[model samples]
Target chain A: MIEFDEVSYGYGGGPLLADVSLRLAAGSFHFLTGPSGAGKTTLLKLCYGELIASQGRVGLFGEDARSLGRDDIAMVRRRIGVVHQDCQFLDHLTVAENIGLPLTVSGRTATEEDLGELIHWVGLDGQRQSRPPELSGGERQRAALARAVVMSPDVILADEPTGNVDWDMSLRLLKLLVELNRMGKTVMIATHDLNLIRTAKQQVQARVLRIASHRVQLAGADL
Target chain B: MSRALAILQFLAGDAQADRVVPPTGFTARLTVFVSATMAFLTVFALALSLATGRLAENWSDALAQSATIRVSAPDGQVEDQVIAVMDVLATTPGVADARALTDDEQRALLEPWFGPDLPLDTLPVPRLIEVIETPEGFDAAGLRARLAGEAPGAVLDDHTRWREPLVRAADRLRTLGLVSILLIAATTGAMITLAANAALAANEQVIRVLRLVGARDAYIARAFVRRYTLRALAGALVGTLFGALAIWLMPEAEATGNFLTGLGFRGVEWLWPFTIPPLAALVAFMATRRAAFATLKERR
Candidate 1:
């Protein structure tokens, strides 16, 4: 579980978010939607230990984020998976190597069967031998998601994961996220697509949070 | 120190062996070429310093323990004065030996400065006597007083006036050689450090990708440390090989020209140049390891 109390974040010059408090309990699903430049990404960064709160406290599992050192933050990150919009990857490494990176970093041995299963699950089996740059848009996103969950994190955060894919690919990606949530993983996604959220509401009991007025708010029926 | 450990690990195949960043052929070539050039120059500096040291020691030791006395007495009285000087020297406690130079020896000694045809017997030039001293050393003042009473024309030369300058020059050359070695070491460290920094900057994207995949600082740094350490080892090996060859090509001590003599490693001293390769590798290891960790932390 993650909690934020009176969290105000600014870049030391101008405030991007002011006096916003939020909580993400275990096994819950959420969508963070907002207009452009509405601190959606900034809020997600705060959720992880990437940015320290300028005003209040952010707790991960139960410990304060600010109190954690570098190693501590790294340990916490292993339990909390993050998928960036750009889908960063090592161009020199093959898709299979990139997919197994999380396990490799944690010093966990990934057997042949486990890796094969993961590739089949992500629908990247055919492209496993190719480099990350050689993959298509949809393939890269799926690859990034595969890397994100390779550690089997308790919480998964995706920032615009389906931004570069087609409508059919977006729904396919959404189904994967839904399947992880069904497995008792806490999922928080930040996206501007309202239709996706409306479609997601039919599959799972997910709450929507909207960012406006430089603060976060729980959107009512309109979402 | 850290470099040796990294090479051990890399050769042992304990590294993560990730291929996130592609290798640059140009940087590898540059590193090898630069290291070789620096090593060649360092070898010459080392030779210059060592050779001058042996010269000063030999010159000082030979001159300080002996002297030459030229007795300028009347032509017919030369034999009487030589016998008198011998008696005075034998009675002195520290006079190890006193012998008059033979006529042929005197002509041979003057042959280099004066032509061999110069008539030594016809000239009124004084007869020469060679004196050798013991460890306790003969006192010049007391010997001079005894020679003045016994043989008025005898004058002693202890060889002190020129001995100290030769020794000081030799000592200074030895210091210069040692300083040159230090400079070479420092240059190697700085160049390797910059090369490591450049390698880090070039692989910024690889680092970001690795970090995203849950790589720790240690893991990322290991990849870089391994690559650079190997590069340094290869570069320095070639450099050291060429340096040793260049040193060996020099005219050895027993060569014809005395001036060109002694310009190389002394016996059993060839082992010192062997340390350069490992030292270069060690420098690369430290520099790359530091740069890798620093960049990783900065990314975090």
Candidate 2:
């Protein structure tokens, strides 16, 4: 769980995000939507302790984010899986190696059976030997999802998970997130796709937060 | 001890950890080349230091053991003065034995400068006496005073004036050689640090991915430290072999008869250069670790 209490952040020049208070309770699903160049990515980074709040407090797992060391932040990150818009991957690694990175880096060995099952669930079993650059946009997104959940993290944060995919592929990706949410994992997805959010709303009860004019607000039920 | 053991454990890392950082082509080659060159120089420095130490010890031992006395009397009185100088040396407390040199001995002493056939007896060459000192040698000042009174033509020359300066020079040269080795180590560390920083900067995306996936700083640092350390070790091994070969191929001291040109190892001294590779590896390990941690902290 993460809590931001009246947090205002600035990068030297001026405040990009101001006086934002939000709490992500256990097993809840939420969506963060904003225009490009807004503080969405910065806010997501704050949730994982990548950036400290310039004013007020940001709490991660009930601990002050500012008080944690890099190692402690890394430990906190192990429980919070992040999926970026670009689907970052070590391009030199095969899909299987990329997906199993979290376990490998944490000194835990991933059995072939477990990795195969996870890959197959993400529809990437046939591309296990293929590197990241050879994968299409949809395949890359699914692979990133598989990697995110390989460790069974407590919370999932996705920044534009369906930003580069088609309609059917976006739904496919959304279905995966919904399935993960049904299994009691807290989920936060940041996107500008209103149709995807509307589609997501029909399947699961996801609260929406919108960032505008340097502050966050709970969106009304206009959609 | 535990810290040392932990460092050893870090150095002996797992293969999975090493795969996190992609193998950088340029930095890898740069590190290997620098390490090999520095290690090659270090081998020579080590040889110079060890050789100078042996030279100093030899000179000090050979010169401290014995001395010579020269008698510059007229041709008719030179033989009698030589005998009188021998008698005075025999009664000295720290002198073990003394003997007047024969004509043949005098000729052999001058054989290098003059030809072997030089007529030593024809010239008015001063008569000489050899003095061997006991462990507790006689004071030169006291012996000089005795020689002056007993045989006015006799001059006691213990070789202290020339020997002390030569010994001091040798000691200084040995110290300079040791300082050169230390500077080589320092330069190796500096080069490795620069190379590691370059690699870290180039692998920014790799670091970002690893950190995003919950890899700790130490885990990421181990990948770099291990790579550089192993590369340095391998390169230094090759350098040391070449250096040893070069030393072995030099002219032998007996053949050259010049101590300065004889900069190679001797007998068990050859084992000394074998340590350079491991030392280079240690320097690489420390340099890479420091740079990696510093970069990680900066990124954070």
Candidate 3:
């Protein structure tokens, strides 16, 4: 679980996110909604220990994030999977290798069968040998999702997982996330897509938090 | 010791670890070229140091075991004084043998500066006696005192003043050679560090991807370190081979009496050049690791 206790962050300028106290409990699903440059990604980074809170503290797995060394942060990262909006990947690696990177980096060997199954589940079986640059937007997102969950992490933090995909593809991605949640993994996704949120609500119950005026607030029914 | 073992283990990496970082051809070639060139120079430096060391030891040992006696009597009395000096040397405890140099021998000694056709008998050059000593050697001061009483015209020349400077010069040359090697190692480390930094900076995205998936800094650094180390090892091996070959092909040491021309390894000393590759690899490993870890910290 990750908790932000009255956290504030800024990049040598005024505060971008202010007094944002939040908790992501076990087996819960949450969506972060905000405008562009609204500190949505920043908040996600703090949760994963990439960016420490400038004011208060961010705690990861019951340990203060600010006190975590490089090795400690690496241990925390292994428990949390992150999907970037850009679907960041090594362009030179094949789709299958990219998906299995998490396991590889953690000093684990993923069997051919396990990698094949994951590739098929992501609808990338035919493109397994293809590199990231050759993939479509939706394929890249799905590949990124597959990579994020390859290690079977306890928590998944996704930032705009469907930003570059069509509505149908977005729903498919949401269903994959919902399936993960149903399997008892905690999930928090940051996005501004209301339709995707409504679509997600039909399948799974998710609390929606909106970032406005440099603070996080639980959104009303209008969202 | 544990760190050395860890480095060995890292160098003997698994196939999966090798694939973590994509190879950059330019950096690889750059590392190899720099390491090879540096290693070549290092070999020559090592040879210079070892050769100078041997030269100094030889000069010290040969000169320390002997002393010459010169008799500067009048032309008619030179032979009588030389005979008296020989008799005094015979009675000395540590003196092995002593004999006066013939006229041709005296001329040969001055052949370089005075030429072979010099009229040695007309000149007032003193008669020279060659002295060979026992292992413990004769006491120069005691002999000088004895010669002063027995043959007043005789001067005991222990060769200390001239030999000390020659031995000292050789020792200083050896030290300079050692300093040159240290400078070469330092220069190699610095160049490799810069190259590693550039490689890391160029592969920032690769590092980010690897770290996002929970790779520790050590794990990431191992990839770079292992790569640079292997490249250095390979390149240095080539350089050392050529350096040894060049040394081997130099004109034979016996062909020329010039000490500097006989600057290569001899007999078992040839094994020394083989160590350069491993040393270069160690330098590369350390340099790349420091750069990788520092850059990773900054990225975090």
Candidate 4:
């Protein structure tokens, strides 16, 4: 769970996110919608303790994010999976290796069968042996998603998971996220794509929060 | 103790952990080459230090228990003064033996400078007496007084003034060699740190990716540290082997006691060079660990 009470963040010019208060409860799905440069990714970063709030407080797992040590933050991160828009992967690693990275880094081993199952689930079985540079945009995104969830984290924060993929691939990714939600894992996605939000709304009980004018507000049933 | 065990465990390493960072050819080569060069120099430094230490010890011990006496008198009275000096030495409590060097012995001592054909009878060369002392040596002051009373032309040369400076020089040489080794180790550390920094910078994306997946700074640092340490170890091992082989192949020391001929390991001293590789690895481990953590903290 993540809680930001009156949290504000800025990069010295002016406030990017100001006077924001929100709570992500356990087993909940959230879609953060905002125009470009509206602090959607920044909010996600604050939730994961990647950036300390410049004012007020951001709490992760009931602990103050600002007060937690680097090691403590890393441990907290093990419970939260993040999928970047660009699908960051070690470019030299094979798809299977990249997907198994979360478990490996956490000092755990994933059996070949389990990793293979996850790879197949991500529709990356054919590209398992290919390096990140050799993969298509959709393949990279799915690989990134597989890597994020290999540890079976309690929360998944995805930023523009479908930005580089086609519509069919986007739906496939959304279905995977929905399946994860059905298994009781909390999911939060930040994107400007309204159709994805509408599609996710019908399949799962996801709340829509839109960032505007440097504040997060819950969008009404208009969508 | 637990910390040491933790370091050992870290050194034992994980195959999976090592695969996280892609192999960097340039930094890898830089570390290995620097380690090898430094380690090669270290072997020589170690050899020089050990050889100088032995030389100092040999000079101190050999000179401490022996001395010399020179009799310079009128040609007719030289034999009498030598006889008196010998008698005085015989009565000394700790004088093990005293013998006047024959004319042939004196000629042989000066053979290198004056040539073997020098006319000893014509040149008025002073007579020399070699004095060997017991473990508890005779007091030079007391023996000097006795010789002055009996033989005015006789001078006691206890060899202190000559031996002290030589022994001191050898000891200082040994210390200098040791200091060189320390400096070499420090230089190796600095070079490895620079290489590690470059590697860390080059692998910034890898670090970001690792951090995103919940890898602690220590986990990431270990990946780099283990690689650099192993490279340094392997390079140093090869360098040390080559260094030791070069030393072994040098010409053996002759009876002339030339320092250059003796500049090598003897017996168990050969084991000293073997320690360089592990020491290089330790230096690499510490340097890489520090750089990795610093870079990670900066990124954070």
DockQ winner between candidates 3 and 4: 4
lDDT (10s digit) by residue, model 1, range B104-195: 89889889999888798789878899999997888898988999999999888887777787788788988998898788767866776677
TM-score of structure candidate 1: 0.91
Q: Tens-digit lDDT track for model 4 on B146-265? A: 889999999989899999999999999999999999999999999999999999999999999898999999999989999999999999998899899989987879943676757999
- Give the proportion of true interface contacts each model preserves, from 0 to 1: 0.52, 0.75, 0.71, 0.79
Backbone clash pairs for candidate 2 read none
TM-score of chain B of 4: 0.94
Residues A18-59 of candidate 1: C-alpha lDDT, one tens digit per residue:
888889999999999999888888898887788889889999
DockQ of each: 0.59, 0.84, 0.80, 0.85
Q: What is the DockQ of candidate 3?
A: 0.80
What number of backbone clashes does candidate 2 have, counting pairs of residues 3 or more apart or in separate chains? 0
Residue-level lDDT tens digits of model 3 in A1-223: 9998999999888999999999999999999999999999999999888898999979899999989998899988999999998988988788898898888888888779779888888899899999999999999999999999888889999999999999989989999999999999999999999989988888888999999999999999986
Ranking by DockQ: 4, 2, 3, 1
Residue A110 CA displacement from its true place in model 1, Å: 4.0
Global local distance difference test of model 4: 0.92
Each model's lDDT comes to 0.82, 0.90, 0.91, 0.92
Top model number, lDDT: 4
Candidate 2 Cα deviation (angstroms), residue B164: 1.7
Error of 2 at B126 (Å): 1.0
Please identify which of the two predictions, 2 or 3, would achieve the higher DockQ against the true structure. Answer: 2
lDDT of 3 by residue, B149-264 (tens): 98999998888999999999999999999999999999989989988998999999999988889999988998888988999899999999988988888888778777665599
